[model samples]
Target: MGAIESAAQAAAWLLAALTRELGLFAAIGLAVGGLDDLAVDGLWIGRSLWRRATVYRRHARMTMATLPPPEEPGAIAIFIGAWSESAVIGAMLRAALAGIRHGDYRIYVGTYPNDPETERAVLGVGDARIRRVGGVLPGPTTKAECLNRIWQSMLADERASGRRFKAIVLHDAEDVIHPHELDLYDRMIERFDLVQIPVLPLLANESRWAWTISATYADEFAESHQKSLVLREAVGAAVPSAGVGCAIQRAMMARIAEQGGGLPFSADSLTEDYELGLRVRAMGGRSAFIAMPVAPGKGLVAVRAHFPETIEAAVRQKTRWIIGIALAGWDRLRWDGGVTERWMRLRDRRAPIAALVLAVAYGALLLSIVCRIAGIRPDWPDALEPILTLTGALLVWRLAMRALFVTKAYGWREGLCAIPRVFIANIIEIAAAWRAVLHYVPGTTPIWDKTRHRFPERVGE
Candidate 1:
């Protein structure tokens, strides 16, 4: 009985000490990050209200139908970088060819020489507009390298046909193209050097909707497209390309290529699409993020695709993103921009830190639960009360905002799911951050850490 009492006291003391440290750390980090998020939320809300009152009051609200069509549609080239994507490339091409309501555009599918199955699938599409550009390098090269091959092909085709493309669009083989996507690009590319539409994850079947990991992407993209990117664009910050549903003017593409010695996308960067968007802004190119609906009460004209549904797949994909944006991106694109740009960059690079805080926060919560169950009272610091209270309130606010945006994009069902999915997302983020640290610390060349992609059975519906 004495030993048991001593053990309980020791455990209680350890819990008390660890809880104070972790709880304090978590509280401070959450407060700082929560304030940052609150600022963004305020900016987004204020800007949106201002626009609705001022701009919409004066002019008719702009929807897809309201946007003026290009008087003379210029040639647009859609580039899809495929490395061992034989399974979905054919379906995606078919969907794009059937869906896109444009006349003067060509599809450039870049496939590695080693990935002949994908190249064959591209050719098998049998559409005259679909052109297969075989990469000089073999499979598993950087996506930027594959895209560069497609760029060269576009240049060669322009020279051969005596027709130049007005804009170049980037997409993945798994993307479901919108019918009026090219129309939006053709109209917007004339005014802006770069234009990005929203990307919504497609929950094609009931299974996909039920998959927690898959549903998380829907919540994430919905909120990001509706709020974060919108806020970024409103503040004139560099809008990062989502790798799909984004178009860059041919002139801007040429400028980027010239600046990078004939490669528009950087081969050195893992997240070349993201880097391309920022580089465009750095080069004084105008960019816009458009999230308009096709009609007054219709769905958004956005790129839709199936995201990784399994935890392992999701972790692998997110690990790549964390390594690229949060780790290597800092080394490549050092802090250089206006205040808004720097603020956005900080948000982008906060993933590792955020993950750490989240981990510690969860650990502390678990410890508190154990203390209660074991009847071990840990005398927490008096100072922690206010901080933890504030943190709790901010967390509720953050979850509410997440649910609000997600509900606005999706429906009430997903909105409710978004609350619990916050925990899932935090776990995945922590796992990905740890994996990213391991992968990035070795100083090895970053290859295409591509995950297996799924195409919707019936896309562009």
Candidate 2:
């Protein structure tokens, strides 16, 4: 075919994909919103309360039975990224102390040489159990690289001491972990090589910014960590790793490092957690997801990372994540070979179709808004109703499941408030994914877009 003819065909295909995606989105919005309303109403009226109550009961029983045995002792290594402020570092130190008190665990904190506050905070823990390493490490200043250096040091220490760690847990500086998180780690050590805990965002009751951060993250974990991980596990699909609240065995970590250390910490990918998860799975390891326990009132653990507190900061962080995960890691994970290599390869190839569809859907919505404002109706055919309906129903089911999980993990008030944020988050994510795609040029060094923490005013000085 002539170049002009080929171009015409490509344009036609793109348009068709966009049209189909828009119909899907509209249907999804309507169905999910409607079902959510129905669920709320039903819960208020008491018909679905039985099911909800039963679920609650089962969860309660599990929590009660899953307490860690006192005899089962394990060491935990916590990695807080470079550039943490004092308040954030302080919170981490407190949690580290708690972790030490709870187990026969030694705390190994990995940080940069220049972070004096982090170093001081490690000392502040005042426990001989805590040790700091890699004060000065080479290579990219990304989280992955920091972790790699720490892991290498840990391996050396273990070899010298002739002892192996039972678990290695990653944590952010702002994390305020529930005491029971250590217990959960102990209980689950026997069943899975790696255990990932759902991370809950701690929002200050008075801060609107906190509310936004809480809702967005809560909804995300609800869907991705809770439901999606469960679904993926059932179907043998590759699961993405959350950066923190995750624990891996020494044996598994060693195995992954032996396999080319997968991708080194670099500026190329912003999502070190996702990349690590992919590499681990690629190396024939198994991972399990445990719901963040709610008994401690705030669940097993919650992270109180300081969000942008302003719109620009939030947008920058979200944009970086979007570009990194959707653009960089998406390609890397899709292409990475492993036990589920073929399946992942196929999923990665088809995943972009969803992003392209979303982009088109947004464009159509903009056009529709414009048309409505101008008193013009762009006619869509009646024949697409069933397709639209099915698409909407599926989306509603997905979101409904997400909302249910969120409500259970947090509370109804938080879950309900998070609905709008969930939509906004998805749009941000889609935009990030597309942005990453456009910038996927060759020879791009991974950029570590560092997030600034709002240290307590006293610490800030």
Which candidate's lDDT is highest?
1
- For candidate 2, the 10 contiguous residues with the lowest summed lDDT are 452-461
Kindly report which residue stretches of model 2 are placed more than 4 angstroms away from their true locations once superposed: 1-60, 64-72, 99-101, 124-126, 135-140, 261-269, 292-298, 301-309, 335-359, 388-399, 454-461
What TM-score, over all chains together, does every model reach? Answer: 0.96, 0.75
At residue 459, what lDDT does model 2 achieve? 18
Candidate 2 local lDDT, 90-141, one digit each (tens): 6557655654335556666666666677667767777776667655654236
| Candidate 1 lDDT over residue span 334-393, tens digit each | 898999999999999999999999999999888878878877667677888898888888
Span of 10 residues, lowest total lDDT, candidate 1 = 202-211
TM-score of 1: 0.96
Candidate 1 ranges with C-alpha deviation above 4 Å: 1-8, 204-210
Candidate 1: the clashing residue pairs are none
lDDT, model 1, position 75: 90
What are the lDDT figures for the candidates, one per model?
Answer: 0.89, 0.60
